[model samples]
Target: MTDPLLTTAELTAFLARDFEQVKDDFTVDEITAQGIKLRLNVAERHLRPGGTVSGPAMFGLADVGAYLAILSRIGLEALTVTTNCSIDFMRKPIAGKDVICDVRLLKLGRQLAVCDALVFSDGDDRPVARASLTYSIPPK
Candidate 1:
């Protein structure tokens, strides 16, 4: 795979600039040869009534993770938007722990991108959720 167009620091800065509302909740962990690792810094608002992470929160994690991975490869393009997301919540997240998503870009084309993310509670071997996503990329 080619080196990413955006580094972790560059992606972080882009998030801060474009997605200020959620910028504080996520961190770019690392850019691996395979994909990008994103961490969701869980806070009180992210928990559900049963002390598990909310479905919407996990969805956000997966969505943002996928978005960042695509941006890493394609550069910080704000016009790239999620076209579809199908997610499965398989297990409850561990309370008091942050969540991590390992994001992989399945395909990247001039006009579209496909990706997926496996969500796990910090320190867990099993995934709590998984998501497959597609994004529409602006033409070059």
Candidate 2:
């Protein structure tokens, strides 16, 4: 396995500097050979009328987690964009708890990277959502 090109601190800093709007919403918990672990701190804004975490909120976490996982291996490519994403909302996420996303990079090629993310509510062993993402890496 190859060493990660970006550390959690570096990825956090990059998000803060480039994506300030969501900088506070996400925390990079760890980066490993498999992929990255991210936490989404739940807030009032992320809740739904049903007293559960909203789907869009979870989707955002999955997307960001996948992006960071790819960047960890390929280095920061700001222009790298999601080419496709398919997500399944398996279960409703608990409110008032942080959502954790375990992202795995399944494949990385010259022009694209494929990843999968499993999102779980804090303290829960079951996944609430699953996402498969493909990103187009910008040409150097």
Candidate 3:
């Protein structure tokens, strides 16, 4: 059977305010037993010329989603740091759409976590970017 997911309220409280990025820009729209749904609040700063979301902005979404996934499983371990990340920009994103990131834990170990993220522009079904990330969680 699949493991149960930790709620966003639990995660936010666990971080003790250090994870402001998640608080400020993202909402835990859904957390099923399998994974999570992270919604990004897009703004003008996230856009590039010709009205596409900037690559860096997409990268940030992926990165933060990974972090949130780790925290969801591990609790508010603010010291967990990104050790590696690989991102693929699959396609240009539509500016008006809110970016939704789906994050799943590939492996959750005692001292580390690996997550995969698929990011999509809100209205469409296709992914705009994909990322795999590893985070180091300090031993308590």
lDDT values, one for every candidate: 0.92, 0.94, 0.80
Model with the higher TM-score, candidate 1 or 3: 1
Clashes in model 3: which pairs?
none
TM-score of each: 0.97, 0.97, 0.88
TM-score ranking, high to low? 2, 1, 3
Task: Mark the regions of model 3 whose C-alpha exceeds 4 Å error after superposition.
Answer: 1-5, 12-16
The residue pairs that clash in candidate 1, if any, are: none
Error of 2 at 117 (Å): 0.4
lDDT of 1: 0.92
Against the true structure, whose lDDT is highest? 2
Please rank every candidate by lDDT, starting with the best: 2, 1, 3
- What is the lDDT, from 0 to 100, of the residue 48 in candidate 3? 91
lDDT of 3 by residue, 12-58 (tens): 56544676554666777776564677888788878899888888888
Q: Who is ahead in lDDT, 1 or 3?
A: 1
